[model samples]
Target chain A: DAGVTQSPTHLIKTRGQHVTLRCSPISGHKSVSWYQQVLGQGPQFIFQYYEKEERGRGNFPDRFSARQFPNYSSELNVNALLLGDSALYLCASSLVSGDGYTFGSGTRLTVV
Target chain B: AQKVTQAQTEISVVEKEDVTLDCVYETRDTTYYLFWYKQPPSGELVFLIRRNSFDEQNEISGRYSWNFQKSTSSFNFTITASQVVDSAVYFCALSAPIYNQGGKLIFGQGTELSVKP
Candidate 1:
């Protein structure tokens, strides 16, 4: 079985630019979530989508948004990225929300 | 609101030795779940184990063990006979159990384990 897959393994953008990270969950999975992992730190939840609806959000600002497709895939978009946005973006999927999240390799985003 | 704290930032153990990583969490909700994940240098988060709020019993899974204590809101993981492959960052996470509502996780700072031969 293919695990959660993330696109654009690495990316570089200038401040104020926008970036979108993609994720395809494991087959037969319905829940997808986004997280941000700063250097030397654990992941911080960004958003959770189940059945195409936004189920939860984190302490992040309005610049961060996400959507879940009918196939349980997901996209994480960051508008006007800041230098602090330089981190790894991770996507996780599971049969149920808020449990055993099988994570992707993560997209490493660098905002200069 | 929920918060998790991992006091140890890093630990080193010789191969074939035993090591324990500590985790403490705080939440207002009575029902929630705790989890442990391992992230190696490859940057993939690997799910290790999960413990629900009511299940405080200690669990032993081969070389991995988890001790859940509700009285102290602590969930600790121990690796016996540690191997070099166990060198990674271990994270402790918490999530609310309510459905229909989006349950986001709150994770600890993580403990980086280094196993040497």
Candidate 2:
């Protein structure tokens, strides 16, 4: 089966701009999670949605938000982007809340 | 609060060498899961293994081995006969039970491995 897929493998935005990243979960998966990975650091959780409901949120700011669709696809939105927001945004899917997760290649976002 | 620590920032070894990456975690949850993920230059997290808090058994798969010791609150990964292909940033992560924290993973800073062929 195809793994989780993320859109716009790479993109650039300016400060104060908004960005949206998309993710399609694996077939039969109901949970989608978002993570931000800064250079040389491990990924940090942003949000998780299960069955189209918000399951959990991380330590990110209000500028970060996400949602899951009926088909289990997800979208992460960042508002008023800052240079510090530049990072690799990863999407992961799992069959259940805490099961093994498969991650996407991630969308590389660069903010100027 | 839960946290994972990988004290080794980077490691370099020649091919055929054996190297162990150490991971120490802190969590109050008696029931939790530990995981190992390898992030190659491709920048995708490749799952390696996941062990439960109740399972202390060591696991071996091909040239890779994982040692899970609950007594030390540690999970360490060893790559035997390392190769250039094994070079990557390896992460150790911890996750709470399903009902806790939405199963979000708590990851360590990661250890970058450089294998010289």
Candidate 3:
């Protein structure tokens, strides 16, 4: 079975622009979570959705938002992007909230 | 607040040598989970192992092994007879059920392991 998949593996955007990153969770997985990883740093949690409902959110600002569809696919939207927002956005899928997660290759967003 | 610490920023070892990566965590919750992930140059976080608070048993899978110690609050990973394939950035993470955070994972800074042939 295919693992979690992300689209637009790489992207470049200007500051103050908006961008959307997409993720398709593994088949039979119900939970999807988002994380942001800065260069030379580990990933930081962003948001998590289960059964199309927001279950958890990290310390990110209001500019960052995410939603999960009934099929368990997810999209992370970032508005008013700042140069600090440039990082690797990763998507992970899990069977349950506390279970092990399977991660995607991640979308690399570069804000210039 | 929960925190995971990976003191070693990077380590290098020759082929067939053994290497151990250290991880220390802090959490007030009595129940929680610990995890180890490997991010290769390709940039995908691969799940390696997960251990819970109740089980402290050391586990070994092929050439990989993990030591979870509650007394020291450490979960260390070791690679036996390491190979170039094992070179990657290894991360240690912790998760606990917080009021608004649910069980979101808090990751450490990660340890970059370089295996030389």
Better of 1 and 3 by lDDT: 3
Top lDDT: which candidate number? 2
Task: State the displacement of the C-alpha of residue A45, model 1, in Å, after optimal TM-score superposition.
Answer: 0.6
Total clashing residue pairs per candidate? 1, 0, 0
Cα error, residue A48 of model 1, in Å, equals 0.4
TM-score of chain A of each: 0.97, 0.99, 0.99
- As a whole number from 0 to 100, the lDDT of residue A6 in candidate 3 is 100
lDDT of 2 by residue, B1-117 (tens): 899999999999999999999999999999999999999999999999999899999999999999999889999999999999999999999996777658999999999999998
Positional deviation of B7 in candidate 1, in angstroms?
Answer: 0.1
- Tens digits of lDDT, candidate 3, B9-82: 99999999999999999999888889999999889999999898999999999999999999999999999999
Comparing 1 with 2 on DockQ, the higher-scoring candidate is 2
| Prediction 3 TM-score vs. true | 0.98
> What digit string (tens of lDDT, one per residue) describes model 2 on residues A43-69?
999998999999899999999999999
Q: Show the lowest summed lDDT stretch of 10 residues, model 1 chain B.
A: B96-105
Per-model DockQ:
0.72, 0.87, 0.75
TM-score for each candidate, following the candidate numbering: 0.96, 0.99, 0.98
